[model samples]
Target: MGTNQVEMCPVARLIFVVYLLVTTCSASPPNFVLLFADDLGFGDLGCYGHPTSITPNLDRLAADGLRFTDFYCTSPVCSPSRASLLTGRYQTRSGVYPGVFYPGSRGGLPLNETTIAEVLKPLGYATAAMGKWHLGLGQNGMYLPTRQGFDHFLGVPYSHDMGPCQNLTCFPPDIKCFGHCDQDVVTIPLMYDDIIKQQPVDFLDLERAYSDFATDFITMSAKKKQPFFLYYPSHHTHYPQFAGPGAAGWSRRGPFGDSLLEFDSTVGNLLSTLENTGVLNNTLILFTADNGPELMRMSRGGNAGLLKCGKGTTYEGGMREPAIAYWPGIITPGVTHELASTLDILPTFAKLAGAKLPMVQLDGVDMTDILVNQGPSKREAMMFYPTDPSVRYGMFALRLGKYKAHFYTRGAGHSETTPDHDCHIISILTPHDPPLLFDLESDPSENYPLSLQGRPDLQALLQKIQAVREKFEATMEFGESQIDKGIDPNLEPCCTPQCTPKPSCCQCD
Candidate 1:
């Protein structure tokens, strides 16, 4: 049998054994709450060292959970990043490149593919997804949340700023585009079984609003002692900023900071809910963002600090994000510098729940040890590809231990200024360049590239990138099998902005 076919060692098994051995007690699967923020950058939170940002709630989360110093989202953009998260696989493998799904776009998550929700639903867990579900939209393809296993979903089908605005600026003084942008003000219109029960959720009051819903959910489930998965996705900090109720005049950082306040309060609310429900000690809470901040417009985002590149680039800023996991009685409060990816969540959750994952090809390994056991890091390298440009889609990135290699094709009009440097068009309309190598450990900022003259090892790593690229090309050229095998037949065709209809849909059975 191939290595891919081998059953991965269950990290949950070790957790269960340890629990029984230490406490002399069997364990019950804890309720899972995934608090996902939209386009939240690495330095946006107070824990990550944002000087002016006040995220007391999230800071508290770090104080109580395992704070990950080197964590990355699978994709750098919103939709594809989210797709990778939902399926626990690289978006590229699933043909979910970058770019938001516009109205009438036929693509969504492939129906046949299993999602985190799908994997958990069968175990008697009520799975719900709230806030930005930007996977895809429309009929005749697989983008709707229902097809992907989310029992309840709310918020915009795509980014609040995806479509054209009333005016050039994302913020509204103009009512025409603003009204369209706020279409979801009345419950982002129901598709499938999911519906936004409430409409016009105040952005500033989001933490309270969503928390109320999630708290109710937890309380209801707790009353019945039922295990449930509540996926809380936030729309704050994305664009078209709305300040939280108490945060209206709070920050000097403008609307961006206001959004951050809402996010902080949201986490605080969840934590409070867990504590009040008597599940704080048992419930496992994972907090992370879809991708790095949007820095092209400084008025909208904060710096990735020393990290090179900001949203929409292959640089660390685009993919690297703030991540922390907490289960008061389970995870020790401290920092882990090991590299971890959002993709690992699926397998990790399965292992923790004592559930066997269905036969499926997953690009992510379960990082249960990193979470529970004080074991060495399991993820040595990660492959990154941003299929979307406007948001994030690095052509290719591979992290081998501390050394990371990035291979990107600079297409036309790539120039965009950022806080640290003047981003300009490079290698435009040309063949890809030699890979850029960086020692992430020595230089977390990725400011200096290792000189090739003294580095044969670096050259070998670049060669590895070339080899990986060749294989990827072969898969695309030969029309490899699609990733999602069980997509709803009624779901639409998921594709990128410059997508060409392939002979077969991007489905993998």
Candidate 2:
């Protein structure tokens, strides 16, 4: 009887192993919906502690998933941050440094760099990028999103403010425009795939258009039973704020708040679509910003809460962003102080989809454990790069554990009419000899500095940080700056049915 039972156990184990393999092979990979906001602040949503900016959808997302308190972007600006987010590497490595790409810029994100879309596409994921492809549009639309592994691309090449009408009166009349708002810059074009769908896009209609396009893609993907990766980088919360009719007068915080509410509604719409398609439980959604608020806009910009300074600076407010991760039946609902960044998105997603990573070295670490089992983050340190053109390579600041050391300090300049009169004072770059160290756990605002005069332990911490920086600098190879390339008018997109003039043919409905 004992010999018979032992033989039966081996057969049972073999059957069980086969069942496990079949179950794993039959289960579909989760769909990825990444919602990235442009110039959104840490305190913009109700879940992040904002009192007035009503974000019920985002608040509910936080309540159902993991909310990160110390999430950051690699850079404080648009193009560089987006580059790092997509490639999972520093902007310097990708050649998209110094500044953002203009419409006429001949260069763009280099072809060698592997994007998140490129990584996921080979694994049978239908990839689409909707809204704000500020990466670049090189000669003959070579560097556009469609050329870079995205199956479908619908959006503008750059910021809406970078157009012929910088200060469009279409925005709320109370908000003031800084800089040369009257300059006759090139008109912004809205693209569908590689073709120009509209020139001088109607800013008021953008939210609806983007939401519709996204829902359609999601529904189509669901019906086809194909896992999809939707990268929705919204143009809202940036300058030249324009809210749709429904959200125009909805906020007490003025146009910025109104535009934010409109963005919140867009998020709500996407959530509803996922549920309607019966893919809500199998989808993993990430909501975050490219960078911090544009405080130079004053009341027209976003609130960074208690953090210091704002966009274009290496301050906490400029780099730290509001990040929420929602995956029903997967991630536990809670807030984590563990440090993470946009860089982690690529490797994390790759791991989840069972896809192979790029061959080249990557700056981002896989954060799957942090999202799944609530384990400690693999990322222990973060480096902050400067947007200033002159100061290229190496980081302006380094955050190791709870301690953050700022090797250089500066603030974004504001216009003369800006109520914050001391902005100019903060704009001047100052180098710290010993590096200004602050305990971010205690002072997330970075208001007070720790003295390195007496404490040996603190001094040792600085030396350790310097060593890490030095090691990184010694091994890192900087890529040529694509953004610094000369601009060419011919590279700009122009719709068909040409107008009378040559360059002015860019105008279309």
Candidate 3:
């Protein structure tokens, strides 16, 4: 027999066994833990090169995983970005084309859509949401975390600052006083299911509150043999920075730095918990922020450098975020200059868990390979829309490769009736307009833009961005007629008679 034929003997069985081992090694399911920081900037983390900032835990986490340098949030603000994340679709598709929603806001993830929890739940994964829930709080028996997909929900229904507040203090009036403001500031305790547990005596240092809840969720899930998903969206370093007692000493950088220190400690605590639980090796931890920092706090906040514009505007700072993916055994550590987005999380997690998605349109792409293999991002284009005219100040932007095009109009009232006025004057909005193209390979800060006057490559990039903008607009279901009628009245206010707060919209006892 030839040598090739001779391999069919018992010795060949040894080779087959080795092949099986290798294949099995490649097919393991990973536990996913997403740590979403609220309104943290691109330069907030130490790994991102923030000077004098203390984010050791995050820095170490970045070292352990692949840090994505060009990651973008689907939207610049919290509610819209989160809506995109949970649905893996643009928030506009779900009617969240606006600001953060409240119990009475007529907006939320549509019932037809499937959340990561809903997708993974059927596949034997224990899913839980442990922090902020900015999606609508359905008008009575219609919308709630448990109804959405999460088996457990513990934390604020919206932004931590959303609850009844006086002078920006998050304290809700005391229930004992029948909603009277007798006591100083009534500490708004966190809500678990329907009960208010410990009142957060002072948000000036509420970082520990978020961390403690996340730790509890981790420990609880670790005890179960099944894979688990923890969506820990922290209320930290957003605004009105509350520096915890442990970080009170760092008040020199103002409340902002104090909040930063507290955030670092919280991340460190979670990592330590994973280590102690012995599941650190198998868990996939994702760290990112909702959007850029509040620009008004620049003196108190970090910088985004030449990327242009800050929060409340459709600039890089408003949309770009610091992202790190750490799964010790699965992902190799390095800097990935890929263009990724927050919307990819839902589908990515679903693919990892072998979960089936309900038939529906999704905007996020499955980037599991990019996460595992590493290198240049597979995504070629990214688009953003400030649906809410108020928050974004009437702007829309799209980025294709290196070229970014944005249109800005003055808010509310202005007419082209006068010679100096034009009906929605469409000038190149940004200082770096006329579609300035940056060779990101050479310019990381985006300070220098190569002249596009003679550059066909840049022109093509601009055209590509325009195409993306068109596609985005075509996909959007705008106008009052497209609104869902079944959504709770509180979520979608109605002028029809006999409309009271819907049952599902009210907090349950």
Best by lDDT: 2
Error of 3 at 287 (Å): 0.7
lDDT of 3 by residue, 1-509 (tens): 00111112445445544543553244434578888888777877678887777777888988877787778887767877887788887776676655666545554666666788888777667777766777766554245577788777777666655433343332122111112221221223455654444344345435566677677777877776567788888777665455645775564565566667787788788889888887887787998888776665544444554454445445576678899988775666677766789888887887666677658887777787676644345566777666363232323656666555554422111111212221122322333346555565466444566676887977777777667766766665542211243333333222222333433122222
lDDT of the candidates, in the order given: 0.65, 0.81, 0.62
My TM-score estimates for the predictions, one after another, are 0.80, 0.91, 0.77
Expressed as tens digits, the lDDT of each residue in 1-509 for candidate 2 is 00101122445546534543542355467789999999998888889988888788999999988899999998889999999999999898888978788878888999889999999888788999998999999888899998888999999988877776544434443333334442444567889999888887877777889999999999999999898999999888888777877688888888878888898999999999999999998788999999888887877778788887778878888889999999886666788888899999999988777778999879999987677655678886898988853335367899988899988876675221234432344457778878999999889888789997789999999999999888777766778989878788667677753554645566777
Candidate 2, poorest ten consecutive residues by summed lDDT: 1-10
Q: Which ten residues in a row have the lowest lDDT in candidate 1?
A: 183-192
Judging by TM-score, tell me the better candidate of 2 and 3: 2
Error of 2 at 139 (Å): 1.1
Q: Rank the candidates by lDDT, best first.
A: 2, 1, 3
- Model 2: how large is the Cα RMSD against the reference? 6.9
True-structure lDDT of candidate 3: 0.62
- Deviation in angstroms for 206 in model 2? 1.3
Q: Per-residue lDDT of 292-361 in model 1, one digit per residue for the tens?
A: 7767556665557667666666678877989989877577677887778888888888877766785866
User: Which is the winner by TM-score between candidate 1 and candidate 2?
Assistant: 2
